[model samples]
Target: MSSIRARLLAALLAGMTVVTLLGTYAIYVNARDAVDELFDYQLRQLALSLRDQAVHHSFAPPAETVAEDFDFVIQVWNPDGVRVYFSQPHRTLPGLAQLGYASITTPDAEWRVFATRLGESIIQVAQPMRVRNAMALNAATRVLVPAFVLLPVLSLLIWLIVGKGLSPLKKLARAVSRRGAQALDPLPVARVPEEVLPVVCALNDLLARLDAALTAQRAFVADAAHELRTPIAALQLQVQLIERAGCEEERAAATTDLKAGVRRASRAVQQLLILARQGSDAESPTLQDFDLGELARSVITGHSVLAAEKAIDLGYTGHEGEVLHLRADAAALQVLLENLVGNAIRYTQRGGRVDVAATRRPAGNIVLEVSDNGPGIPPAERERVFDRFYRGTTAEEPGSGLGLAIVRAIAERHRAKLELDDSEMGGLRVRLTFPMPEHPPASP
Candidate 1:
């Protein structure tokens, strides 16, 4: 894995080295120019000084006597170009040339020569190019050597600074790792850098949501346990009654009651399962474009036998044979409709009417309503009806009290608006308004 500190250190060190090399090259070039100018000036001054000095035709110094470090090679010649005098018996002395400065290349080395007139004779002062080059190299080495020596120190400093800058991220990782599974508390946000603040805030928000979901799950489990206790106990009691019956008639009656108790227990268990499945953190619904009116008719038909037994007039009263299209989770919407229609059938008085309808409003919203001519919920208790395990004060029927709660949960998932109101039929009307899609699918 590539570490941020390592990458930063390498990049910084590489950049510093490149800059150092460039700086050294610039210093070498400038030093070379300065040395060349100084040496050229010295050559001109030497040639001018020789103009007044005495010159001997055979005054050349012995080759062995010349110092190894000696750089200048002075020479003189007559107007006829015959060599007259030379300061040193150098192997590569430049020949006499026209007055002023010039450069000449010999087999051994290149020379910078300054020639001037000394009365009838001509004097020439020359120096090798290698001498000036050595001076420039020494000047550049003074700068380059220090930079190379300090490179390790610069690399160390860069590594420490990069690590220090990343300390906040390290702290955050440690804090997250130390948390327990049940520790859903928000992470600290204080002293967080501006660049990392958004990440911390988002994590805090996620923790808050998880805490709420876990709390609701715990409550749901507890409530389900409490609600199931009564029916299960009743089933046991009814079985005991059947076992104790003395006559054939008494045993038959006891068996019938036991069956009823079993049915009630089964119904309660089913409702509890439905409630759990519709909880906030339950699996997402499968949404599709389906006919809402058809779903309503189907739900009413399923509850028709029960409605008929009680003499309740259960029927669909929406537009005949017209499709009331809606975009929603079809299965969840079916469950919502079943709960509404079943509750209406169970609670309406004998010979009363329970109507289920689905219609599209002019403003492009789908409205689903299940209304019944039964004793309506009081206005004060309407809001509380949607709470889990809550029943109306005047309720006389056996129920798990989760029907309306399930309906409300499904409505919330679909982002639909649910309302409880007095129906025109003189009873409760549960209406749900679902917003239409901006661009609806094409009909077949």
Candidate 2:
């Protein structure tokens, strides 16, 4: 069969054939019962008729001609149960009781017998059971032959019907096969059956997400290429200038420029590395309890030279109680703090102020703020400052614009929130807040 409908139809027809055979057997049994009743009644009446003939004649009569018509035997027995006459002289049929009708077996075969009593003797009439059984077999065969012939034809018709029932599923398969690889449009769900609608809707949602990811990746690549080209070109020019300098002083000046270019390029490369390690579902960083105050102090100490060189004040001003134990990736926290402090030190002029502080709030929350007296980011450009290669409106410093972006990436990885507000130094305030771990040391 070409379809499921056809297969089902064939199966149904085969089942019907089996049922029909059973029905024919039942009908045959009913017919055999009816015929046996009529035959037995005829034998009973024949015995009574022969008895009357003998009584009227008052003689031990010669053998009767009843056997010529009925193809059976007739016998008579005296009242003392002595056999007087036999229809088949080769084998004697046994006389039965004077009751209605009975059956008996001879040496050769079985017989159906009828018996009745006369004045002084009993008469019996019987027929062989083999003849009756043969007749029943012939009749049953005649009735069942037609059903056997029609079974195959009905099976074929059933197969065709089942094939038609599965047509819709085949059509859906073909429609899906014709689509191209990048075709993300949703399949039409309106005409589909209820069982299949959910599958189509899910595919459509997947396609929509794929389209958005592709667009974002394109924008990221373009921005990265644009950002990397500037430093690379500057490094190349600085190297060439160092080579072509005419005097020792000129060569020394070119070497300094070359070193500066190398530093910028190294920073750009480090930013890219941080971005690569920043987002992964599988590689969550190890977290531990760390003192926020200690971390802030350490970051400030690392940047002491920068602050001293610029003549700016850089130090910590927060609670002395170590009540601010935080759960975070320590490495990421260090990177985050270093970037914020570095940015603050870079932007502030000589004699400017930069403060690092970690303060504990009321409800297991620790607030860490790094503020500077440099020109602050304007309100309109603060949001874009976290974007890759996005520089703030008041940013006139010479550096890659990825420091805040790296800070945001690290914060997101740790599920912490970083906010920007107006600093007490009349400049920018970059605050990083995280929940304090429960069951920590009260104070140390």
Candidate 3:
């Protein structure tokens, strides 16, 4: 029953059986009616033929002759309603009645009798109902026997036709099963039936997306390995220097350099990890509503000590007490804010100012900006600054060039638009615009 072929066969065969039975019943009823009309006509004709003759009581036909002629009984009666002459002697017979054609039931059998009078002498022709019924049954059988005999042949034909109709699906399954794991090519569409074309096209689309994802993953791994090589070699050289220190002061100095090298190498590895996580296609961001301004202030607070160490002034300067609510992945947004603020603090000159702000525009779009009074990126290198391991010409800081790349990746995940421009403070400004829902959730 689970198989389509079996289900179809069962349903079709059941339907055919029901139709055949109904047809046979209809044929039997029609045949029986026709036989009754024909026998009744014959009864009337025989009675009429005898009406003109002298059915003499002295010259009665033999019982065997009457039985063999037409399985009928004949009788001649006088006007007095007395038993006159009967061709066949039986256990019961129809009593004389006044009628042209009538049906009478005797103790032995049901009889169809026809009577006609010829000048006060009556002739009756009678036949049993069972004879008519047998004729009807025989006619029905003759008409329906061919259909009954062909039933099994028709069932076999249905099975073969159903199998032929489903052969395309079987071929498709075999073709798909024969492929290797790495074979992401689309299935061929030529000669595909219209009914199955949609499934084929959707599968092809899925295969194409899988291929693209794998290619991107391979390139990311290769780029990450290539970018990590320089920092690792630098750390090794620093370790060697620390091992070959000559005196106490020299050993202390070498140790300090080694510590800085270790910090740089650790920062690079951390950045690579963040970039990899942001670029992953498998992990989807958790979207929720949060106060964007509060998040901006929290990031600035975390980077406050660094800003102070560089003698840079960093603060939030958006609408003072108004809440700027945004719906996005809160964790990813936090990382984006941290990278932007850290970069601004690191690259800004001493005594320079860096400001962070989050604001909601009249159009319900949320905008975030981080600006600094540092040597900004030139217009030509601004676009390339977001590429992994790409440093600007004006960059004088000794650090990995992954901050903006990480920020861009996070922004893209949140469907935000990021742009770099000259700040009003005579430095670089990074702005991100996030689209808002028409009916945003209320603050809790």
Worst 10 residues of 1 by lDDT: 89-98
Show the colliding residue pairs in model 3.
none
Query: Across residues 312-381, which tens digit of lDDT does each residue of candidate 1 receive?
Result: 9999999988887777799888889888888888889999999999998999888989999999999999
Kindly report which residue pairs in candidate 2 clash with one another.
Answer: 4-162, 5-162, 5-163, 6-159, 6-162, 6-163, 9-158
Q: Candidate 2 lDDT, tens digit per residue, 1-444?
A: 364565567568767877888877886787677667878878877887886574332223345743454567777778777777676666655555556677678887788888778778787777887767666666777878887787777767666655555555677678768878667676777777665567667867877777665665677678778999998898889889988999999999999998988888898888877875674322787888788799889899999999999999999988766656777788888988999999999999889999999998888678889999898888788899998888876788987888998888888887678899889878999988775565665555
Q: What TM-score, to 2 decimals, does candidate 3 have?
A: 0.70
Off by over 4 Å in 2: 1-210, 280-285, 435-444
Name the lDDT of candidate 3.
Answer: 0.87
Error of 3 at 100 (Å): 16
Q: Higher-lDDT candidate among 1 and 2?
A: 1
Q: Give the higher-lDDT candidate: 1 or 3.
A: 1
> What lDDT does each candidate get?
0.89, 0.78, 0.87
Tens-place lDDT digits, model 3, residues 131-200:
9888888887886788879889988999999999888889888988998989999999999988778888
Q: Superpose all Cα atoms of candidate 3 onto the true structure and report the RMSD in Å to 1 decimal.
A: 5.8
List where candidate 1 sits over 4 angstroms from the true fold. 1-155
Candidate 3 lDDT for residue 120 = 82
